[model samples]
Target: MPHQPIPPPHRTYARAMRAEATKPENLLWQALRNRQLEGFKFKRQVPLDGYILDFVCFEARLIVEVDGGQHSGAIGDAVRDRHFEAQGFRTLRFWNDEVEKELDAVCRAILHEAEGRIG
Candidate 1:
């Protein structure tokens, strides 16, 4: 197996970040938290492989990122994606606007991707 980055020892920081979830993240979390979507359990602000994932479904090996404008074409994101991919995890990123404007569609897409991975 390829070497993967390990999660940093920053539980305090991660916990603080989780407390201040962005609007888009809060919105999506309403749908994803507590296995609300198709019974697929999702966790918020999870620390994994040296990154704080916005949302994670461990069973599906899926990491969902609700990105703001700053994330567009970000090289760092590419590197993060590759790191998770190396660990057999798939990442799905959605813009803040997309999540805010088309929440239903985004949820559908997330559900589809998660189901595909699960099945």
Candidate 2:
């Protein structure tokens, strides 16, 4: 079943992200922080309009989302994806399992995508 889209709590969620919903995000952030990953700068838990992104690189107009099993299906995710695409941001989604079980692969995929955008 598709999960329901929980609209971001707007501006406030941006500030409280550190305390409110930091874990799932942190698991990814820890790997991307501090100009890491071949100097790829990623911003975490960033607020963009009505959404909070797992990771973003404004220069690349890229939004990388790490989704858990509960986010399965096409309904909610599709809707949210359309919104982001409409706003000129390209989104890349990966399952949490993929990130956890295939960390190097996930990192390589992200780098490959970024490289594609660069050229």
Candidate 3:
């Protein structure tokens, strides 16, 4: 059965996402785009149902979020994770520092996690 389309995000939310996605996306996106990592494709700044995700690996059902200072010590992250979990998508979060300071490590972690999801 085809899934019904969820309502579009509010206009302000969509615009903010576009601006943030272009301006603040982590380095991981560069590596993920164009199938640079093990031929896995990723979409950046995507809308999936009610929320917009930083990066989504659709085939693997993984959502990667690059969080900034605001998310630090903020419990809302867990709540958001639960929402994605309920929808059958695994959420991976990396702080901006992790991506900027240890990009190679982040890339490896993503690869490892994705591998586990495969047969």
Candidate 4:
């Protein structure tokens, strides 16, 4: 009998987060899923480097975060960004309200960034 390894804690948490996504996350996911954003593949609620990223496109090395009011001026975010940057990934953050109100603009920015990285 072979034993299976348990999934990491961050992976489990990320799965739960994907299942119960916030409104803004949902909105963004709709735009990013199925390579809809300029043929770039995006995965939501992905676990990476001990953190659960809201969305990540490995090919483009981009991570998108949809933040709420609680995240305003969060110092911890800077540390996380630096860590990801060191891994050669750029992080793009948008407020929840910004996503809800300016979904097209948000998608455009994401596409632009992803294109830049991919190219």
Q: List per-prediction Cα lDDT, in the order shown.
A: 0.89, 0.74, 0.76, 0.91
lDDT of 2 by residue, 6-117 (tens): 5557556766875664354666677777867677788877776557788887666778998877788968778878887887778899888777777778777877777677
lDDT of 1 by residue, 22-84 (tens): 989899999998889999999988776567889999899999999998998999999999989
The candidate that wins on TM-score is 4
List runs of model 3 lying over 4 Å from the truth. Answer: 1-16, 22-26
**Residue pair clashes in candidate 1:** 7-50
lDDT for 46 in candidate 3 is 73
Candidate 1: count the clashes: 1
C-alpha RMSD for every candidate: 2.1, 5.9, 2.6, 4.6
Give the lowest summed-lDDT range of ten residues in model 2. 1-10
Q: Candidate 4: deviation at residue 62, Å?
A: 0.3
Residue 72, model 3: lDDT of: 87
- TM-score of candidate 2 to 2 decimals: 0.79
Ranking by lDDT: 4, 1, 3, 2
lDDT of 3 by residue, 2-69 (tens): 33465555445756775666333746778889989898888877765666778888788788888888
**What's the TM-score of every candidate structure?**
0.92, 0.79, 0.82, 0.92
In model 3, what lDDT does residue 66 have? 87
List model 4 lDDT by residue over 7-115, tens digit each.
6886789889999999999999999999998889999998776778899999999999999989999999999999889888999999999999999999999999988
Comparing candidate 1 with candidate 2, which one achieves the higher TM-score? 1
List the candidates ranked by TM-score, beginning with the highest. 4, 1, 3, 2
Clashes of each: 1, 0, 0, 0
